[model samples]
Target chain A: MAEPRPAILIVEDEPEIRRFLRTAFGVEGYRVVESATGRRGSIDAGTHKPDLAIVDLALPDVDGIEVIRRIREWSPMPIIVLSARVQERSKIEALDAGANDYVTKPFGIGELLARVRAALRHAVRSPSGTSILRFGNTVVDLEKRTALRDEEEIRLTPIEFRLLAMLAKQLGMVVTHRHLLTVVWGPTHEKDTHYLRIYMKQLRDKLEIDPVRPRHLLTETGVGYRLVLDE
Target chain B: MVSIDKQRKPPAHPFSKIPAIFMGNLQRSWATVLRMNLKRHWVGYAWAVGAAAACTFVGLVMYPRFDLVNVAMVYLLAVVIIALRFSRGPAIAASVLFVAAFDFVFVPPRGTFTVDDIQYLLTFAIMLSVGLIISRLVKSVRRQAAAQAALEIEAETERIRSTLLASISHDLRTPLAVMAGASSSLAESGERLSAAERHALAKSVFDQAQEMSEHVAKVLQMTRLETGAIKVDRDWASLSEIVGAVLARLGERMAAHRVIVELPDDLPLVRVDATLIEQALGNLLENAAKHTPPATVVRVCAQRRGEEVIVTVQDYSAGLSDRDLERVFAKFHRGSVEGAGAGMGLGLAICRAIVRLHGGQTWAERVPGGGTAFRFTLPLEEAPSAPLELASN
Candidate 1:
């Protein structure tokens, strides 16, 4: 067990929230570096060079989006945002500003932990990610342009494959509608969310066991879509 | 000494009573302004003139067939009716106009303002007095009715305030008590308790905190909906997607009941704020889960009816009374069985408000086989054009 432990940087203004996060991350066998303001958070990101960073959007000195931008300028470290339920617009904005993921305020520590683990694992994986994705009995191979459900090949339109590939690229993290639409349907259709809705339903119908309560391809309500795969 | 103090209290110096003098003058000015406002009803004056003309015409016709005293009686009736219908200004105007017209047309002078009989002066005086007295009486009654209406509004405000306070103290205080007791126990006696016991206490604290947060969020959301702070960001969305998201959000809360969904495959895409619609549907599911007993079946169904889509959440429980069915959507209206963990009864109210903001209607009705159905409609819109992949591929 000579592997160096992963480090996490927490940028939050409230001392109470920071205290709990410290304890939670500590108990989970991760080293934590705390910053009380966004300015200090950006500085610490450059100094500590942590494997990942969890930043609160409501910072005292600067906007959390600013911190993410500064970090993006120099590092490709996984950045996850902590936002309140009221900050729905900024949550999407943070994602569009290069944030890898977000956890809403008043969230269970388990939910945050799962997100953190996924983001870190995604960072460690190949930059192109895995070509083959699996959801329950369904398997989709992006490179091969194939989808199978229970070993039977299911036909998917080219747009559906492209949408799946875009979601799979940010697998386990929220991919904003703007990001997916821009990448899959070109920049002209960035604001056309119905395309995503129609295609997502099509994908879910063909792949999911029960399309109504999907286990893998999930909708993020006003935010975006997240593609989760069984390990 | 007491007499001297009383004398001092009466303000020995004139300067000491300056504020009192000023207040009296201010009150008089306000009364004048109110009187000016009362006289601003020109329509009433017009009606008064019309009434006087009609009485004059009738009086002239009766000058040959009836007595002059009877014509004066007609003038008195016109004054009384005008006083009852309008303010003092119109009443006085009606009486004065009638007197001049009667003297000029029906009196000794056939077309002049000269009166030959002294008793005609008596008739004019009586008409003026009657007009003034009736207008004063009518004005006082109107003032009383306006005061009563204002008092009713104040009482309503007081009722809502008390209800809000009661709800906050009951719903929010319970969670506060649990969190305080549980956390204090863990802080003071963590070493003495077993691992499972400590875990249970911690979990209760967490669950209570979550419940408290939800209650607070609902209160805030209701206020935001009422204050016009919520902007409905409409987009092309599917009812099936919104329904699925709500079920997943209410995962464990609805787990106790046997939930069934019946949505048609060809359901059209609706243009609405998806997140708000999700919350609206979630509240219905939560209400159904809260009222019904465990293991009862709850059905979520949707159908396209004409230009709108009707979504229903039906629960197979003891149906609500006719009164409760209507009152359920009113703010702070609770059901008969308010078990522990019951909300402040704002879920349905919030649901109704959100649905209305989306140009939809919500209602509750009893199902035939002994259950309640909560239904709402979302107006449909023309579907957007889907992208073609042929040329791009």
Candidate 2:
């Protein structure tokens, strides 16, 4: 039997952007639900029950963050934010407000499609996330709290293990500094961003082939860190 | 005073920053003038009265030993000193005060407001005229300085406007023209072209659009940096992470160059706006890749020296000439080699601005082995103490 096509809800004010997005998503064999305003977007989110939502941060009717909040209130659907380069602060705000991923404006459709696919795949995966995260030759089993490279076992500090597990929970998506710090080091250490910098380097040095130019443990610049795992 | 003709003929591109240099001097002079005048406005009158009283005491003592003319000359000296040291108001007040005191205390009539000698009347006129003339000269000099500053700012604004217009027409118009032509052809006669030709046309449209978007972004970013609109959101950040992010962002752009990153494992974290630093580093790398030949090595390295971390991006290409090295960081300065790359020549300028905002310095030098090295220094701070954790391995 053919599987039901996944639906994608796009909340954007510009009809031209919507038209291109609709065409791109349509050509990719996904059902697209369009909303011209934030109010209608929140309404469509409940009615359509899409597998993913692409929300433009700057909307005409209401703030896009409000739409993300509204959808997150009732649904666990993956939401990808479309932000302009100028909206750096608000982009991070949207991501922290439960957005799964983001693609900056003037971005090619292929970038957006990859983010959408990652967010959608992340949605259908296990709630506890993949226990075994693999990148390059390094394999980390979060459930067992063991890291191995090739056939050799690698020692990971307790904080390193916890940081890996926190990043693993949001696999393939950006985990904000505040989120990672809060989860791994507790709420009191949320603002201690130096801890994240220190630990992320250690993690990268241990797992990445070239720690300076990491291929999997990615830094999203000002936003946070993203851990990409091999399928 | 500034002439209207200078406004019509804006300075050339080479001297574009002359106005900024002029503005620095203007600001410093204004600051010094303001600091001197801050407490001198209302207090100058008191100083005028005080000087007159002090001269009156000297005149009273001199009247008993010398001729009354010597006492009159002493009052005249007070007026000359006041005129030299103060504004017109204080100078005029000092002149009138000295004249009244001389007439009351020393002129034939002792301790009364009367002038018994007409020659002393000439002395009063001379004192008043000196005060007015000196103050007028001082005021003119100040006004001239102010007018000169305003003229420089106006000429600079005109220069920037023209340069911006010229850059827009040259950099943005090319890609826009290609995009318009290609898209129209695809729309008007898609079925007439072969599959590969159609794909190539569409791909060119996409590529041109992307290129134009980058140009527009650089223009906007330069504008924002110039206007002081971008605020640095600083936090503790790792330089390696920043470099990693830049390399990733410039993946395809740097693919032609053999990129090498040499950061130490124990490199301390820097407090900076990581996003801006990433852009700054990315621009430098992109510039190196754009100017250097393919397969040449481009190295990115950072070393801690004293309290600063010096980051260098070295490209093994033909080095810039001495003059080119000096002007490479200027806006709209393209590489000397033609057809090497196409950019609005704002990458290094923007990189300099971003680095400067973080209290860092950026410069380019000729590498020893026929290449250029673009280096910047970022000041380092003591790393924040992290919470101690057990290994529990």
TM-score of chain B of 2: 0.81
Best of the candidates, lDDT: 1
lDDT of 2 at B6: 45
Report the lDDT of model 2 for residue B361: 94
lDDT of 2 by residue, B77-164 (tens): 7777776677877888888998888888887777788767778789779878887888778878888999999999999999978887
Cα lDDT tens digits, model 2, A1-231, are 299999999999999999999999999999999999999999999998999999998898899999999999999999999997564688789988989889888888998998888788778884877788887898888888888999799988888888888777778888898898888889998889998888888788899998888888899988888888776
**C-alpha positional error of residue A63 in candidate 2 after TM-score superposition, expressed in Å:** 0.5
Model 1 chain A is weakest, by summed lDDT over 10 consecutive residues, at: A84-93
> Any runs in candidate 1 off by more than 4 Å, and if so which?
A1-4, A39-50, A60-76, B1-40, B106-110, B114-129, B390-393
**Model 1: pairs clashing at backbone N, Cα or C within 3 Å:** none
iRMSD of all candidate structures: 1.9, 1.6
Candidate 2: regions farther than 4 A off: A85-87, B1-40, B53-81, B335-342, B390-393
Instruction: State how far residue B175 of model 1 sits from its true place (Å).
Output: 1.8
